[model samples]
Target: MPTTRDYEYLLECANVIGVDYNEAENRVKVFVSQKMPPETLADEDDVKKRVQETDADVTVDVVDAGYDDERAGYEPLSTLEVIPEALEGRGERHRPVPAGVSEINAISTAGTGGPYPARVTADATDEASGAVWSDAVGADDLVRLSNNHVYARSNEADLGEPILQPSPQDGGESDDEVGALVGYVPIDDGVRVDVAARSVDRDRESDRYLELEDEWPTGVRRDGYEELREETVTKTGRTTGVTSATVEATSASVNVDFGEGGTITLRDQLITGYMSEPGDSGSAVFLEDGELVGLLFAGSTEQTICNRIANVEADLGVEILTEEPDDGNGDGGGDREPPVYTTTFERALEVDLEGASLDLESVTFGGRPQPGATVPLRIAVVASEPGSYWVDVDGDRERFEIGGESSDDLGHTVTASAAVPEDAAGTLSVSIAGGRLE
Candidate 1:
């Protein structure tokens, strides 16, 4: 088995800016700049020799792109058509600060705000690069969350330095101060995250993102990168407003160029197609159901990079505040419908027992498949002898024993259930295993 540590060693190659592990394919995708052609990148033989060392079944693929921390400093873009406040282009300032607007250090930089005034947990931090995120309450005060490069200026800003709304680039003045830098997870070699936070008055911010006022980041998704692969993700930002993209890779390693702050390698990054522009840093990434997934920080024309929200919470030592589900009472929690999460390919199968006149009929599954959700299965056995038999579906099995003697006209029905795997794909194999006449 190839460990993640082994995959990180592949970054040692020249011009290899990033790498991602595709668990389903058992492939390691190497992201290199256009300056280096894919052909020149380490081929399968070379990668195996350099990284695999062991007989781990790993393949290598080369992709071309460059990446940078996405912080558009104060430069203005044309106004988009007026829409819902949540979906509006957020370069301009708002009275009550909401996420997805220009917010950054009081210096000359700019990035978007994430979910404001919400209590969020763990992640890293930096300054002067991207958006501020949720309103996680620190020990004594409400904390405004964002990328370290946006709030702490990539570890350069002083604690207690003023943070501004609308960013200086968007004409925010000293009077627009909403918070001050309190802490950040430092960016370093092989850093897992680039997040930071500042203290703000609860009254100065809204606990919601713009253009997504109705949906709160309900919870932080703690599942690994594999869960997010191919899943649809969305972000609201100072630069792009609201945009959606499919997650291309979950366990991606990125070389984030932070301009004057130089470049650094971020591992375990969440990769998405182009859904962000400069000044979109610190934007919170969400699943279709509004679960917080990652914190947007870096990107290129080809891809966006994010710190997984779970990592953010671990590094920042704060819980990301999410809206509580309404219990149909007068108390708190947002009112949102239960989500119908989908799974991979659906399959149906039938089987026959060898050396035993048992006909397994209509081995069918009930309910739409959701990843890891249990679906009930019913298998009817005809002309069955009284025996102990097992039914298998994609390696999971349930046993059924017939108590009566063999009969020609009788039919026995048995119930079994299987939980779909996360990487469910292709056909499902259903069969009788360990069948024996009693």
Candidate 2:
């Protein structure tokens, strides 16, 4: 029964350092690095001893690389034609089947032959990458949407150029013409409205509903702009196929690297768990029940970025044909606006200031604290400047300040104990705030 504190502690220990919380398993997964020779990797016995240090039930998973090596910054190879905007080559992946290798007859995933919503190929200048299809535009304008980089060759493509499904890289040959470039929205501030790749063959019917993540809402419920905050999301792309995540930020401003030393600052964007890989761009993100939410354009090892679907439709002048479009005359049927939010710690969560620091990692009680049962509590802190520290559980607070140079060190981290005051019971609200931001 390890607590979150014990989980953090395991990450700092050797042999069991490369791990992440498995919320489903309720345990930490220890990844044995294979970067070292197999014989040199941490053995089960050694890892178990380290796991015992924190009294955590840890699962050791041996992998070919260490955590640091696994998350290395992605940088695509040189040569401007091949690299895409804001994308990089992946380290290596273990997919069910080699992605882009097996093309099913249907456009469900890694497939070609027809315009399908799940996975399709696109081409320009004799080069290709996977393009996620967006909806249509105008009366009969069946437009499929994708990045200007993937479909338009980074904005250098001519109007009506052939865009292949299951891009040539995945075996789409010159004869595999599915659609021609019809529309493109400009990318500004790392966000773009609508961009199109339309079907050249009117008989080559494509599905209006998404071909992947059928378990989620099977159709677009409504324009999801108002539902952006903390929304649960899922997506299907060519490379990574289908994956799920929670939206971390509805509005964010940040810079994105587009390879070849080109980087641009994007604002008013959505951020989510790093559920995407390199070639997942153009994957359509949706709410369960299948309402379009965002378009997957950029991502990394730790986070993914998307454009709002409403923005996509607006910019492209296209209309998404969801099973349930919002009623134009009213605010739909059922709606409840959550309270406006306040920043809990805006400037406080900064990573490594130029000068001093105070990073509160964890605070945990020995066990479930009972009313009138005071127990030993542990506090884990990483600091550049030492000072008095405080912990709060359900509004009950306590402090532990190390005086003098007694606990001073640059790598200064001390495991200190506090007390869970009597009367602390039930589910508790816990928080810790201290240290100045540089």
Candidate 3:
């Protein structure tokens, strides 16, 4: 098998624009600029020959737009005349703006919105552009999320600038402004993420995506690379509306040409089929279960490009709040099932007692936990006594008091809460060793 470093060298090739590696199949799909001649890098046979130099067992594949066509970056501009009318949701002003609608910075032309609603971490600074991705929360504010090129005008627009819905091209005016540019992760060479945010006006904030009536992102799946390989994913965008495609590559590096902004290489991108178009930039990409996966940015006629949602949050210092925040009044109180189930561990105390006994029943998580966030760890126990009990969850030792139970009738249940480590991931193993205190 060719090491990742070995295949990375191909990206340096002038004609080679993108690369996808399928570890299971031992296949390498090379996407070369369509402007290149067939004799140079377009020929599959020639590309395969080049692969033989590395490892004969590895398969080499070349992706192109065919003989007469050329592949170019799908700039974030509406080409409604070329797109089928049925697929284009007539760009128009929408109250409490939803995802999959047309939006852009006042200074720029157009692009789709972010997949979900979002806010920036700091105060607004300037105007904005590009399609909104989705509504998100940052620094306790509701902000609109999208590509930097879309919301931040490719890092050109000043902060706090107006962001209009339906886009200026769609007849949007100053009165239609929804938010202002708060901040963005500046685009740079080998940019790992292309994301920006704007403070959403209270009246324009919404959690709905166009076609997905009631569905919304429940969580962010950061390291779903293995699960998404060859899996199906979908996105709702300005030009394409709702579309589905197979995830061709979970890890991709591509050179995107931004016209005057120049060509910059983007690393660690998700590649899908031709499910997007020019105006689809900033659309949120999701798994079938509605987990936010990537943020759509650039693509070609043959494939789509997106920055992983995980990278979007890390680079922007924000979290895509999947659920609504508490109302603070604390009036809404009830017990509900968790949104998702995660791996957990259950263990019995294994110590027998005459009258008083203890058993560790189960440990559960309310939802997907991330670093720096407190996870509500629930521990179920059945005991016969009231005293301080120590439980070891993974490595974090938790001590809690168990009271009001002294029985062998199996009628007593005690629940204790604990905290997981900052680096928690995968399964959570829990064990306990405690007895009734005097």
Candidate 4:
């Protein structure tokens, strides 16, 4: 759990090495040019001393000049000499400046102002001929040096606009349109109604088909020219946005089978236009008004399948009723739980000091504590002679006198106060513990 400052520092380090973060993969990748090795204190100490003697004036020249278009032709150079007039009276020896030598201060102020930059060369004239005389710049090394100073400054300027506030939950009108489908019932219409019609009669035998006795007529012929009826319904799925479509042209109940061996069937009337995608298989689908409708089980290439709320309730031995209905309000959106702390408790202890005839002054227990969380501690002691005893836990301490009336069969009772430590992330333990005499 890094803070904003920590993230800022990390970003700075990345910029120094020319890298950017990938949010989707949660990774940092090299995004720009290779980073130059940081100039080290030990390596530049002599050069820095020389520059200081010259009143901060210094000049560098590329002994073997070469063109580098990407870096604006600023060839890698070596510090030839420091001609400081201020050190003319000092014992420092003088060295002649080279002819046609380029002034280091004229290049980049960043290179000349601070500590003298490290010189690197790759030509045959450089020491270790045929080898590139370069300094090492590890990923972490570049990040540590560049993040706080360079990358952070650039990022702050680039992101100039203030952060946009999150939209308020109560700002918009509630949409009552069926949000998601849960289940559906079949209507045995000798003539299946087209999807374009707004409404259809359920009681007309020739127009509607019923699957259960509750929806059937009191007296009807069991055999004749029979027609099958089916209904497609949908519900809101957790992962998939919504599920509404059904598998038509099949005599069996609409059941969707995922290629992964999972199946889901609609046991009641399903809402229309519901769809699902991968990863939404186990999502709980709710009705448009936010009622628990069904649990999405599977989906096909063109349809989704969910277990009906009523059927699920019967199977699980529970009631299927709307306990809380959505009021077209948006306040209830978002995940329900907060982030969990994963840090471990490094140490724990319990102490018992009873029937010990000794000078007992005070005691203390110490450990790293979690912020805003309490730590429990208990202390007990006994002594033959009545005296004053003190106890300390964390940094807080208290004293208690135990004599005659104050002494019980259990001896002296000393309780340690609970506390949360300030340095909650680092190792902390009791450094010392002892008791003093009355």
Best by TM-score: 3
Task: Predict model 3's lDDT versus the native.
Answer: 0.64
Worst 10 residues of 2 by lDDT: 88-97
How close to the true structure is residue 43 of candidate 1, measured as C-alpha lDDT?
Answer: 64
Q: Alpha-carbon error at 271 in model 4, in Å?
A: 5.3
Candidate 2 ranges beyond 4 A from true positions:
1-139, 190-194, 208-226, 323-438
lDDT of 2: 0.43
| Candidate 1 wrong stretches, greater than 4 Å | 35-56, 66-89, 118-140, 324-438
Evaluate residue 158 in candidate 2 and report its C-alpha lDDT on the 0 to 100 scale: 61
What ranking of all candidate models by TM-score puts the best one first?
3, 1, 2, 4
Question: What TM-score, over all chains together, does every model reach?
Answer: 0.63, 0.43, 0.65, 0.20
lDDT of 3 at 153: 78
How many Å off is the CA of 132 in candidate 1? 17
Q: Model 4, 6-33: lDDT tens per residue?
A: 2112212211111122222332222111
Higher-lDDT candidate of 2 and 3: 3
Go through the candidates in order and give each one's C-alpha lDDT.
Answer: 0.64, 0.43, 0.64, 0.24
Compose the digit string of candidate 2's lDDT tens values, residues 145-171. Answer: 665545554445566667554455455
Residue 298, candidate 2: Cα error in Å is 0.5
